[model samples]
Target: MGEVGLRTVRDGQRVLRFQAAVIGAATSQRGSSPRWSELVVYRMVDGHYLISKIGRSTVAHQPTCLRVNHRMVPWSKAAAFGEDSVQRVPCPDCRPELGHGIAPDTMLEVTRYRAILCQTAESAAESLMGDRAALLMPQIVQTVLAQCSESDPNFSRYAEADTALPRAWENTTRTP
Candidate 1:
């Protein structure tokens, strides 16, 4: 695997704990996102922590940084509470490659993540359990979140709210 990137640590211990939670969630819901299985963690030369998506598929694996505020709340949580928080810029090259004639500029909405998760769960349920009930299970979503959490401590906190999986895949119009 390539050196995904660097992860800076403002508080390593807390970030590690959150990382575990993310991993657990991802493992439990492997079927949620095809990209989930390819996630990895790396510590940067600068001492920052990075969670990278590393796979041969079109899915994007961008690095995000983690930080905490005075109340001991994670940056994501702090954002929810209306506190100023550190931010990570999206990877300039990380864009989804839509296949089968999808327009280049089409943006994937946030809800698509939920739809994809639900579809995957429903397919699994239908094939294995003989019922679609598994589609509605909270455990699956939790697993995805957990995996995301583990891959990047800030993943669940940051991207979960604002980033859309499909948008992340859109082809950038700018020339590098």
Candidate 2:
């Protein structure tokens, strides 16, 4: 462990710097094992601390291990020692427990998917139904337009169609 003595600060606080290097157990079943995280704790504004950050740190999510009496300790056990005993939370960006998988799509992505579905349906109607696809244009438009007060945000992206939307609809709507 190392500490950099007090230095001048913008707010004039004697920021103490300490470092701990921790070797984490390999958490991944497939990817490379968990990498080393070096953590450095900066003093709190009013000396508020959480018993989380301690060792070789990364971002908040990949925070340092907890410590006791200027000695590093495991996070789970350190929490029992209470706030006064703890030092600081991790980077807050580091989320070690969260599994790494395909990031879940946001509502905006869902809306885009809905638009894609609409485009696909339009293509199928024109290709398979031919002249009858004309009759379905108004129905499709109405169905899209009539959705009001609905929880689905899909229409928000769907309705903002390109100017060619109605022209395409008209082309598909004409009777044989």
Best by the TM-score measure:
1
- For model 1, where is the 10-residue window of minimal lDDT? 109-118
lDDT of each: 0.30, 0.25
Best by lDDT: 1
lDDT of 1 by residue, 1-176 (tens): 12433332222223222221112222222533432223333333433333422221112222221221122333233334332222222223554333343333322211011111112322322222222233343443434444544454444442242221223235455556
Candidate 1, residue 43: CA error in Å? 3.3
Range of the 10 consecutive residues with the lowest summed lDDT in candidate 2: 106-115
After TM-score superposition, the amount by which residue 152's alpha carbon in candidate 1 deviates from its true location, in angstroms, is: 9.7
TM-score of each: 0.18, 0.14
TM-score of 2: 0.14
Q: Model 1, residue 9: displacement in angstroms?
A: 18
Report how far off residue 60 is in candidate 1 (Å).
20
